[model samples]
Target: MTRPRRRVKLARIVNERKRKAALKRRKKALIKSLNTICVLCGAEACMVICDRTNNQGTHNKMVWPSKEQAEAMMSRFKSLPQEQREKKAVSNEMFLQSLLAKKSKKLESLRAKNNQMEMEEILHNFAIDPTSIEPATGKLTRLFLYINDLIAKIEENESMSQSATNVNLV
Candidate 1:
């Protein structure tokens, strides 16, 4: 049986020789995978790796399917309209903004639901024993306002239902 692979730490390798060797092996594997995917899906694919500055202060690059194919693909991409090119682009800032908005909306929704539940519980308790919450002036005012709001909603719903019934009878 094949042994399971151990999880590798997602950190930069400190040893220069080991790091470069691993990079070479991994780059080859990546290009192989890209070729396999293209062959299986009948799709054009390219991979580029821009290495960090070496001791000589020179950068190196690795490109799959030759430099010519990658350049053609890049040029084709550049020819597209600006809007079309960035239609579904998600940078870190954009992603975080969207996430923040979603979380804020959800938080607001939860707060409203919690307030509704708390008001309902208070109303139930007050109905069971009116003297239990009489000591708090602020709570009493809030409870009164909540009750008024509930009454208004109930009346609105009843009027709409009655109007619908009348319309059906006509």
Candidate 2:
């Protein structure tokens, strides 16, 4: 059998100001309920309602380990053999270094892609327009100035790269 559609309760407040105030109060209560921490565990284990109901609904919070329990577990781990601890530390360091290197590579690739897109946009704007050569007034003058600046920058970059390559060879 097909399930019947659930009906939602309409707000009793008809006035605009009163309805807004009611909404604000309900929002504050919901936020407070969600931020509530459990007494048994130190974790924020408050349950949130996903239904269409206006009520905050039931709390089905999960009980996690308290701070004392976590500290005890850590102490047990620290009491392991010196060689094992060293191996664990070394592996953690290597893992962290590899993660950092991977992130750096991704950032470098994004930067290169951004630079290439900007260069292509500049080339498209400057090279595709033939009107800049016909006049020496207003927009044409500005375009010619921008193109000259871009040419100077390209020459400077080429010289810098050539110098760097020569230094690397030495």
Candidate 3:
């Protein structure tokens, strides 16, 4: 007899399969609806941002090199037993090297993004003295307004004292 957990798992699997089928059907319909002809090869294709050899009838570009092509290549390499499969091995090695370089570039970009984000946080949060006409926000602006009010009060007292002195002199 199936346990309670097993029943739950089966229900989840059924739901997931339905979801996958719906998604697949949607994709197929969209592809079918693609009305554009491929410019590069003049084939009926579904790609939107079509660029030459990336010309595609579908989202996946590099259709496998074909069994016949592989067999031909194998036969050529077989004829040169001494030459071995050095070319194929070298090509594979280069492919991995390029992949490694791409990964390195992506990592560098992420690190730069993080560094710039931290710098932005510092710029926004830094405290500036509020006496100047420069733009301010949040607590900084409030502090500036408070200081300006104090300065205005002091000026009013100074002007009143000067007028009193003038009146005494007269």
Candidate 4:
């Protein structure tokens, strides 16, 4: 029969050295069980983010590589045989080119959309009468009335100037 597992009383451990040693062992075991290794590049120094599901089955959580680890992995890849290295380089170049092309296409599409909106705005301003487009709200009616009064004042001034000029000519 399997012996009952003993519970560790970490709080009760008074010896500092023993407590530190127990903590180290526990940390190592936890790390080992968690398998903190990068599945992509097989780098041991990595961080686990979260678990993900796939068609095959559930797998261990994804591992994100640190900058130093990623650089080391890249160096290892560079040290590969000549033909393999060349093939990888070509594939990487193609991947980067494809990404750049995709980004450029997206940027062009955004610019086209922005230009279309600007053209529509310009055309709307020139083609459509603002007052005819919709019924005036109370605020807009007040604004229009104010504008009419200004126009009437301008016309009165022009007529007065014309009458003064006629009297001078007579």
RMSD of each: 5.1, 14.6, 20.8, 23.5
Q: Where is model 4 poorest over a 10-residue stretch in terms of lDDT?
A: 131-140
> What are the lDDT scores of the predictions, listed in order?
0.90, 0.64, 0.57, 0.65
Residue 143: error of model 1 in Å?
1.3
Provide the lDDT at 122 for model 4.
44
**Global CA lDDT of candidate 2, please?**
0.64
Candidate number achieving the greatest lDDT relative to the actual structure? 1
- Write the residue-wise lDDT of candidate 1 on 1-170 in tens digits: 99998998999999999998989998888888888999999988788899998788988877888899999998998899999989988999999999999999999999989988988888899889988786556778888888899899999999999999999999
Alpha-carbon runs more than 4 Å astray in model 1: 1-70, 135-137, 166-170
* Clash tally for model 3: 0
Task: Give the winner by lDDT: 1 or 2.
Answer: 1
Against the true structure, candidate 2 reaches a TM-score of 0.27
Candidate 2 lDDT over residue span 1-170, tens digit each = 99995874675777868776866676666656545644445543423333223346654332224456546656776798888768746577798999999999999999977866765665576588654344544555555566687799999999999999999999
* Top candidate (TM-score): 1
Question: Tens-digit lDDT track for model 4 on 84-130?
Answer: 86874557779899999999999999997785565455446536765
Q: Please provide, for model 3 over 13-114, each residue's C-alpha lDDT reduced to its tens digit, 9 standing for 90 to 100.
A: 347667567556755555545433334456433233221242454353321134465466567767886656465465777989999999999999999778
Q: Could you tell me which residue pairs clash in candidate 4?
A: none
What's the TM-score of each model vs. the native?
Answer: 0.58, 0.27, 0.28, 0.26
**lDDT of candidate 1?**
0.90
TM-score sort, best first: 1, 3, 2, 4
